[model samples]
Target: MSSPDATPGASSAIGSALYQLATRAVRRLPRDLSLTSAATLATLDKTGPRRVTDLAAHEGVTQPAMTVLVRALEESGLVERRGDVSDKRVTLVCLTEDGASYVRARRQAGVEAFQRLIDQLTEDEVRALAAALPALRRLDTLDGQKREGTRP
Candidate 1:
C-alpha cells in the first residue's frame, strides 16, 4: 500500500477526506426540502432570474424536468415566472420573497450543521481545517472564475 505521506497519495487523501465531509454535510441538511427544490432555489439566488432552459442547464436536468420542478416551486409560492424583459417570448424563473427566505434558512441550517460536526473534531483538526480554508477558497474562486470568465 502506498504510504499516506507519499506525494502521489497526498491528493487522493485530501480528495477522500473532502468527499466524506461533503457527504456528511449534505446529510445534515434540512429533511423537508428535496434536493431538487433546494438546488433550484440556490441556482436562482446565485444567478438571478434565468430562462427555464438555463436553469435546467445549471441543474443538469432535462428541460421538461426543470419545467415540472419550477412549476412545483411556483405552486409553493417560492418562485414565479415572468416574461423576460429583453424578449417577451422568453419566460424567466425568479425567486419570490418566500423563496429567498427559504434559501437563507437552508443556508443557515447547513452552517449550523457543519458547526455541529466540527464540534466533534479535535482541536488540532479544527485548526488544520481553519488553516486550509484560504487555499480551499482560493481554489474555489479560481474555479468559479474560469466558469464565469471573470474574476469574482
Candidate 2:
C-alpha cells in the first residue's frame, strides 16, 4: 500500500488514523486521572501557571468544569491555587512538585511504551519513522501555535 504522504486526498485518512492510534495507545495505559486532567497537567508542565479561565479555554472546557477539575487536583495535592503576582484578584493554578513528578513519570511511561512498540517494527519501518520525526515534531509546534492563536 502507498504511504499516506505519497497519495493525494489522503490527509483525512492519515489524520483519522493518527487520532485512532493515539487514543488507543492512551486507553491501553493504566491511569488514575481522566484524559482532561492529564492534558491539563501536561499543559501546565509545558507552559507555566495559568488562570483557571485560561486553562478552561485552552482545554476546550467550560470554566466551571475546569474549576471542578482544578479543585479535584488540589485535593489530590497535585496542584495549588495562588494569587497571581501581577493581578492579585485573579487566581492561578500552579502545578505542585508532586504534579510535576507525576507528569514526568507519565511521559516516561509513554516513551517506554512507544519504544517497545517501535522495537517490534522492521528496520526499514523504524528508519521511516525516524525520518518523519522532524515533521511530526513540527506538527506538534503547529498545534501549539494554533492553541496560542498565533497560527492561521
Using TM-score, give the best candidate's number: 2
Over all chains combined, what TM-score does candidate 1 have? 0.83
Task: Give the residue spans of candidate 2 off by over 4 A.
Answer: 1-6
Please write out the lDDT profile of model 1 over residues 21-99, one tens digit for every residue.
8798788787776887898899889889999987887777899999999999999999999998899899999999999
* 30-143: candidate 2 lDDT, tens digit per residue: 679999999999999999999999999999999999999999999999999999889889999999999999999999988998899999999999999999899789778888
Among all windows of ten consecutive residues in candidate 1, which has the lowest summed lDDT?
Answer: 143-152
lDDT of 1: 0.87
* Count of clashes, each model: 0, 0
lDDT of each: 0.87, 0.91
Worst 10 residues of 2 by lDDT: 1-10
Candidate 1 lDDT at 2 equals: 46
What's the TM-score of each model vs. the native?
0.83, 0.90
The residue-level lDDT of candidate 2 at 102 comes to: 94
The regions of model 1 sitting more than 4 angstroms off are 1-6, 142-152
